[model samples]
Target: MHGEPADEGQYTVVAKNPVDKVQASAKVSVCTKSKVDKLADVAVNIGENARIQCQYSGIPISTIIWYKDGKLIPTNDQRFVITQETPTLSVLTINNTDMDDKGVYSVKLTNTTGDVEGKVNLTVKPIKPAITRDLDTSYTGTKGEDLILSIAGTDNPYPTCQWVKNNTELTPTTDPRIQFKENKKTNEYFLIIKNATQNHMEEYQAQLINVSGLIKSKKNKITIQKQPTFIKKLQTIRVNQTDTGKMECQIDALPQTRVYF
Candidate 1:
């Protein structure tokens, strides 16, 4: 008698006695089973609003319940809202969806006859693409030697990278001695200076550009080493034999080079 139209009708019961018969009659009303509409899955970014809805049909609806991950959800929470569009439609709204909001959501409808339940999945996407750190650049280049200035950066979404020296962007040059290379695996950029000289010594920095905009890394103070040079030649002094004397010279050098007398 679950859902048979024929089962819906009038029924009568009669008791027969020796001389007279009495009968009782009543009408049977078949209550329709509660039917719940399926809910669709939702995918949204963090800090965005999300809505899940379902519809039910029955003779009389007792209550509508909403649950998240098998736990009953109360409307007291400010972030959650339960609303009824019509007698048969119910909606659950989540304000400012976050990572914690990602889960299975279910809605149930109960009536005097029966109850029905439906579920939907929610996915909240995370935000990324911001630069985290730019390691400090510090390198000492020996004069007339191949030198490298490496800049390391970290970011969620990969970005366009470049090197800047003396407030100017570095690019491919006709000079084969000078080269620029990028290490995609490590997210690092390298600037190689061949035959490094005083000219190549300058404040070097790394720059990153992406949809978020341009971001610059810490400056790298580059220093080039040079051989020592005498500012004034040693002075000659005529000394008697076996007399103790000292020879003095005025010199200038980078990195404080050791001087031999």
Candidate 2:
């Protein structure tokens, strides 16, 4: 016999002969397979809690399970909390989410009739940018040589990097001698100065900014070293046997220089 909602009731079947009659009664039940009705993706910041909810429609739900990236979520894990507020609602909470917690989360609902599954994507955003590798406090380069300042770090959603020299921002378009470069995969940034000169010697810093926040590197000084050069040649003078004569010469150099006769 076909099963329907209206057929869910007690019934009796009788077999009667000329003088004898027999009857048996039974109850019928109607079952419906579960199906996911609503589910949504969730995004949360690092160190924050993430909540994923699933809404389903069905009858006689027998079991509910949660999974991450196709692996069953362990109930013993303290970071994961699973709850069913109602027969049709299921919730999963992840406490203190980090980069590893970001993945595809799914819910499986089972009933006497059939089982249904639903999934949601979890995204964990990183906090403020941090400098894993910092620039040196001081850098020295020879004049007319190439110099490169580099910094490495981690950041979410990527970040805009800027080079600051003596309080002035450095850009490729504004300064032809300077070039800025970044490697997204490595999370590294670079400031390149071609044919380094005395003008490039100054305090430098790197500023990183994104939606989360801004971070700046420590102040670094770039010194350009130059070889000593004679500004004035020695002068020759004639003097008598008892007469006194003087000879003088001028020299210029970076970091100052000592003169000897």
Candidate 3:
């Protein structure tokens, strides 16, 4: 192209490289590599979310894939779902996971240039359940006494409570031996034992189950001991020095309960 230059106008010529200039080789050949991409100290909890990320240093960002303990993690449990606007390749999600879900995860960036791998450890923390009770321990009640069992605890969503007796689970049966009551106002649970019996006097526990797992309260036992009755008996007894009748005392219990001074 040619251009006319005015007296005050400045003009210059520019040169372009040959069409095959890009095809020229420096000495012989060269190749690029996929950049390293990895996350660090990743931590999460059960019923929580976690995201692993890696950025590419190469001219072009590499295609990355997340792996859990050397196993390729799918977008949908093995499906490849690409997310837009992010440099991430794959994401692994564990719903209501356990201690077993923890492991080392690697980010593998594979592309036409080469392959790069970066590692990170996934830490899934254990969830500790919170517990609440109406009372710590109770005194032995009379026969046919109604005992309430109420338990509350904290968890991700909520905590589940169950009454365990001698390591055996008990369900509401038609035998009418036990009754279950839930206090909505207090958000507590109760196990009512109607007409307490010696058989009901055994080791019992309130177990709490949450997303993490099952946890038991301190071992508790129900003692069915009854109180002794006091009686004032009138007896004419002769005193050696006074030579007069003095009052006497006697206490008795139907079940032969023990008397403590």
Candidate 4:
């Protein structure tokens, strides 16, 4: 049928068309997938190629159109093409989907006599990687604090994770006090700091990088908890004795540490 309504419907003046008044006030008969009003849930990752299909069941078959952001997105954009063979409508192919593609998509069904609409939301997210860490890294001899460094997010594209300290890369192979470990299967990465030093007290970063050279998460700074230390010196007025507040503390650690108790 042409874009215009033209002479499509069975309607006319003064009983000119037999079916005009019979079905004028009634909606088109929907028997199949047309009973429902919307598409199924769709989840896609950024930079991935995805397809969204809308469906409706009816005996008379329905004509469908798709819209993005409320406007008709012609089947031209490389990221968006249309396929009609499938009941409701088909999103041909969305190439290189990105953050911008995340939104609500609508499918409009139009028949000579009536029309109906439905919508679906598209969500794009980076893969979350497995993560592990040495929770505590506090001590009197070295840097006084608990530390952990690693990006906990991962994906199928094999995310590149790096620890940043004061905007600098934190490499485990070279740094003696730092240990960086990653388990790809679990998508877990860990940063272990042994006998931390004052230098480890600086800003810590965990960045998740992908093949597309896109950084999903920026320098996620890891929090560090440093224990408080107190020193006291006391002198007795007995004119003969000098005393120092003998304050001694012992620390014991588990899994990722040592004990001084």
Candidate 5:
């Protein structure tokens, strides 16, 4: 039996008969079995490409098959491409990958001897944040008080928060008496308004932003109730000794405060 290439040589057997001698020769060849080298894990951001590569050694390098999560990947898929860097090295490249492409990937090298497999884990990192829920629609507060306007949302890498008041962006440091806060535990963002007044009783919104994009919550109306504000003070008029004396005042109040003498 032929064991290895070193053992492959001409084998001659001689037989001698009464008047003739016959000799026959045969040759044999042996090659190494298929073996797949170790592969490293791959990680790439969304919309980028992920490449998994491995090397194999055999007498004849056979076909390379790619599998994802134990399922065979179609070679005709445009997003998946196979390339051979050398006779023994093969690479599987996934283009424009997303979260769905994250899984364990295996490449099998098949030869006459047997099949050898290599595995690599693919991690597709989320690049952008997504807003799952917006902020509350309306909030009510009393004048001369502190108010907390909160908005809730979700994202991949956690999103930042901003507050918008009356169509103007409110910067925490620059804006007067306004503070921006975030609750990482609950993923809630807040716009704290101190000394809220009638001026703050307008449309307010919270903006959740991240590397992906920015999303504004629905317009939140802040209904601020204040005490009576008198536009014109009471005026007194005397009509010559016992003629009718009348007093009148002009006032403005939220929720229409009742006025009495």
Candidate 6:
């Protein structure tokens, strides 16, 4: 028998002997393997529940299994809820969905005859950017020295970072001494100033922007000072008794320091 629904039925056989006649009858049952009919992709925002449905058709389904990213999902996981609303329909619900839950999900149905599988993709909606580690309130550097300011943040879609100084945007093209960089592994952004000078002293900020939203870090002040150096040594002058004496020296320093004798 082909084991199809139409092929199931009852059959009878009769045999006649020299003086007696006997008849026997038997009923046959058909079993069919499950087949996936529909599995639609799903999308949800973070902190929301993600539900995926799988529909199939079969005669006697023995078991159902779910997998994420080709790895079998453990039943002991409390975040996942699996329910069979009907013999042919199954649902998988993920509570408090996060970025980690976004991936390809698959469902497999098995029976004595055979098994069938279906897959669907899950996506987590992007959220507004947030600052995890902010820059220091102030940074001090010396003339001819290099300065770096960094900030770390988290976001669904990686955001672009812009450095602003005294309300003006800073870019490498405009100022060769300035450079912007990012560490994708740590989600940290950096603004570097090569050969820092007094001109680089100002209030700076970092702007993080993405499709979801934009965020700005706290303003950080950069202070640059030049080391003091003596341009000329003090000279001693000798005079006769009751005469006035003079001594002088020259020095260069930032902020103009006063000399005392």
TM-score of 1: 0.47
lDDT of 4 by residue, 1-261 (tens): 232324334443343465554323322332433444447757887778768777675445677777778988765576687777666445545778877777788877766546778888887765544333322233223344445554455464677777667777877655777887877776766667876655555555566666445352343433334444424333343433575444344443221243243
lDDT of 5 by residue, 76-182 (tens): 78999888899888888899886789999988878788787778899988755544566567887887789987767775556788777787888866657888888
**Cα deviation of 242, candidate 4, in Å:** 55
Which scores better on lDDT, 2 or 3? 2
**What lDDT score belongs to each candidate, Candidate 1 first?**
0.77, 0.87, 0.62, 0.59, 0.80, 0.87
Ranking by lDDT: 6, 2, 5, 1, 3, 4
Q: Residues 1-261, candidate 2, lDDT per residue (tens digit)? A: 776667788889999999999999998887778888888999999878999988887766647788999999987889999888997788899998878899999888889887888889999987888899999999999877789999998766577898898878877786798988899999999999998888887999998887788999998999998788888989888988998888998886776788888
Model 5 vs. true fold: TM:
0.52
Q: Relative to the unseen true structure, what is the C-alpha lDDT of residue 212 in candidate 1, on a scale of 0 to 100?
A: 48
**lDDT, residue 84, model 3:** 32
lDDT tens per residue, model 3, 1-261:
232222223334454586533332222122347766545667887556665555555534567676788987755552223443465334544555556668887777776667888888878776766675533654455644665555766554345678877788767773368776665555566677877766777666777676678767665677665555557766766678857655766665435665443
List clashing residue pairs in candidate 3: 74-78, 144-195, 149-189, 149-190, 149-191, 150-189
Candidate 1, 1-261: lDDT as tens digits: 575645777899999999999999998776677787557999987778999888777765647899999999866789998898988888899998867899999877788876788889998875543445564567787877898766665543456777777788777673466688877787777778888777777888778775546777788888888777778888889888999988888765666777775
Q: Which stretch of 10 consecutive residues in model 5 shows the poorest summed lDDT? A: 127-136
What would you estimate as the lDDT of candidate 6? 0.87
Best prediction by TM-score: 6
Model 2: pairs clashing at backbone N, Cα or C within 3 Å: none
True-vs-predicted CA distance for residue 89, candidate 6, Å: 7.1
For candidate 5, the per-residue lDDT at 256 reads 80
* Model 5: CA > 4 A from native: 9-18, 128-261
- Model 1 lDDT, residue 83, Cα: 91
- Considering lDDT, which of the candidate structures 1 and 3 is the better prediction for this target? 1
